[model samples]
Target chain A: MTDWQAFFIALLQGATELFPVSSLGHAVVVPALLHWAFRQADPSFVPFLTLLHLGTATALVILYWRDWLGIVKGFVRGAVRGRIEAENERLAMLLLAGTIPGGLIGFLLERPLKALFATPRVAALFLILNGAILLTAEALRRRSERRDLSREEQEQQFKSAQQITFKAAFVTGGAQALALLPGISRSGVTICGGLLAGLRHQEAARFSFLLATPIIAAAGLLEVPQLFSQRGPLALYAAAAVVAGLAAYISARFLIRYFRAGRLDPYGWYCAAFGLLALILLR
Target chain B: METRGNPALAGVVAALGALFVIISALYAFGAVSFATSDPGAAHHYKHALVALAIAVACLVAANVVRPKAA
Candidate 1:
């Protein structure tokens, strides 16, 4: 791919990666819709995509440095004392619990699911379905008299990561696994799970991002090694990765803050509009 | 102007809008092609990269250039 092509994909990767609208869905559909000659089986494609994800994962890490730092401190302090700090222990456990369902399902179905990546029509249809899901989530949030509570009030309603039970994480993780489908968004589904579990939007968003970091990193770790095996100059890929990473970091920061203070209606509307347009144009 | 609470959110939306506008304009004026074909792949990739750079830069700038406190 040309440098310009790489850049656009990087930008798309960065922007869609964070948005509630599925980035993978767009990546799959956009190329196909544009009649790009990208072969899903191309040796370079998966690694290139992995690099893009690495960029995004790195961005998330940087953007949420404070949160991660706290988690690490909590973990280390708890470990040294031969006892887990209640908060840190719970946070770590929640993350692990959230990771499991998606990890197992993704591993078992990786090959079969990836084949679907080539078909943009399916992705488009799924995008429409995702739109429906988001609208449903908005409806649920609205109907529930869950007044926009203050942060402190919100805290009282939900337990911290450490306090979250295994059952809750498992459910959220199961929801996350659905993101394996191209248009089903990881954040959207997981956040929906969080909200349904009675966590406020902002809290759910925070957990979703935190949960995403490890999963995304694991995906990058698995795929990035392939780039090495193929034996290309790493510099260009590194530059692309860095560009993608920076974009992702900024995007993540924007999204976390956005979901915190804003209503979900705008995103729901956007998804509905985009999904409708895709169906009309593609079909 | 009430500039508290969701300024970051507004900035992101505005930035995304600008990107859509530029991309749409390029496609409309024959400056860029959105069709799916061999040449289109090259065009799409190149245009997408430029768009990505512009979008990323705009977002970063938004984060860095804070609005004056209301």
Candidate 2:
């Protein structure tokens, strides 16, 4: 990939990785739609992709450092006492419950899934499907909201992300596995899961972001050694990573504020429209 | 008031985590083969990393489930 191409791809990764859109889908379809020559099968490609992921992961870590610190401290305290009593400790376990399913599934199925669905045409189709998933989630959430709630139930509707049950967290985390498909969005599905679990949009988004950090970081860190072993434009790759990190940081900051009152409708429409346009053009 | 813990479950979970750690170590040291016919450095690294993650999760879960006496 040229420097400019790498830069653009990095920016895309940073933004979409956080946005409720599918980054992998865009990575596949965008280049093909634009007729860029880079293939996913290129030897250096995986390592480069991992570097970009690492950059995004770092940005997330930095953004949520306070929360992470609390989680770690709470986890350690709980571990030492052999009891998860604190909110932070419970949140830590909730995240772990959520992480396991997706991590295992991703580890086992990522290659096969990518091989089967990594094509631009396939990605475009899934991108459209992703939009459908988002819209369905929104519709369901709206439906749930319209139902009259008892006084106690009304309090439950606004439960903080950290207050969600372990089962809910696990299900939400499991939803992330769907993102292995090129066009399925990790954040999108997790947020949907959170919403279904009774969190408000902002809280669901928060949980989704927290749940994402570990998996993304793991995906990137696992490939760190390869980043050095593979040759060609190391400096450029590093620069791209930095750019991706900055982009991701910005996107994350923006989304946290946006989700306070924003719904996923705009993103849903964008994904559907963009995917359709790409399908027609690529054909 | 007193709180109780699930010792048996915690032990099982910890044991499972230990098994994964052992398996990861074996794979890293070439004692066991991974999915690939001739697993290269990348495959090994990936397996080891994944194993480590599973193990950590298991250990943490075990810790959380087994409460210390108060």
> How large is the i-RMS for each model, in angstroms?
18.5, 3.3
In candidate 1, stretches whose alpha carbon ends up further than 4 angstroms from where it belongs are: A73-85, A146-163, A231-233, B1-70
* TM-score of structure candidate 1: 0.72
**Cα distance off (Å), candidate 2, residue A114:** 1.1
DockQ of each: 0.01, 0.44
Q: Give the chain B TM-score achieved by candidate 2.
A: 0.79
After superposition, the stretches of candidate 2 with alpha carbons farther than 4 Å from their true spots are A146-157, B1-19, B31-43, B66-70
The TM-score of candidate 2's chain A against the true chain A comes to 0.94
lDDT of 1 by residue, A21-84 (tens): 8888888887777777785446667677778889889888887788788776754553344233
Model 1: lDDT of residue A241: 82
Candidate 2, DockQ score (0 to 1)? 0.44
For each candidate, report what fraction of the true interface contacts it reproduces: 0.00, 0.45
In order, candidate lDDTs are 0.67, 0.84
